[model samples]
Target: MVLWVFGYGSLIWKAGFRYEERLVGFINGYSRVFYQGSTDHRGTPDYPGRTVTLEPSHGEVCWGVAYKVSGEEDEQIALSYLEVREKQYDTKVYLDFFTDPNTTTPAVSGVMVYIGSPNKKLNPNYLGPASLEEIAEQIINAEGPSGPNRDYIFQLENALLEIGCEDKHVMDLANAVRKTLSEMKMDS
Candidate 1:
């Protein structure tokens, strides 16, 4: 059984399972924008947020990678991504999307995905503005069982770049984190 998954934000490249098919999907109603969405280590419950959502279907093209997997693999992928966003909302899905017609790659088959949820009831106080600078600073400065957000930024950055779906918000966070780390080094 082949399963199709949609990754609008970070999951496109972050999936731990291997996919048989890969395509560039243009998801409607959403853009790669960062807003406070979760309490998970990646984005926080409220303040320290990451970009992931759809406002209005503006027809704006964002690159998403679709992958095919079996039922067991699908569950594992979902479980491996076990975080507040996935469990709290369970909003990942596999739906209609138009891929670039120009590409010579074969059209991928449709399947299931983990769609993002609409439950905003988890919103919390803003630790700060939802800026790349802010997110980077928070991750760099974060402490607790959560670990460092900068590490998440770096790993996500590498994976996204490898897949060619790099987002401005992510890059911004990377740079901000790097700068802050460098400054901290000098201060030390």
Candidate 2:
């Protein structure tokens, strides 16, 4: 069977896997937050990097992309790759994807999404609810096998802009990180 996967974070900028089709869309009833800690991709265990996790928010819609895996073999490969890449995200949910941000019609249904829950037990790497500056500070100096954590924020910001999706949280954090980086350069 074909599979549809929703990308709200790094997946937007880098799918890192093969897919038959990709469509820009959004899902309702969720708000993207940088509440998940990333020890594997963006930081070490000692200093975990912050990443996006969808928090259940009524009346909120998170804009992202949906990738369709057509072949069964390709679907298996894509899911396996994602499972490893998103190892820290312990929860998975399915939601309807709407291409039109303002429309209620779903272009695709039962699109899979990986989530890092706020429950510490379920999501061991969850670092829930921090101030914008606090998160930027953590993101600033954090690096992992993937690369600098700051790059993640900037890339996501740019990707969202490219897709015509204006996310306040992402924009604010990106600005904060940029300002912090500028201040650091001035200080040195």
Candidate number of the best lDDT: 2
Residues 17-60 of candidate 1: C-alpha lDDT, one tens digit per residue? 66666666655445554443445555444434343544344755
TM-score of every prediction relative to native: 0.65, 0.98
The TM-score of candidate 1 is 0.65
Please give the lDDT score at residue 18 for candidate 2: 93
Pairs with steric clashes in candidate 2: none
Q: List where candidate 2 sits over 4 angstroms from the true fold.
A: none
Q: What ranges in model 1 sit over 4 Å off? A: 8-10, 17-29, 36-57, 71-85, 97-119, 122-129, 143-147
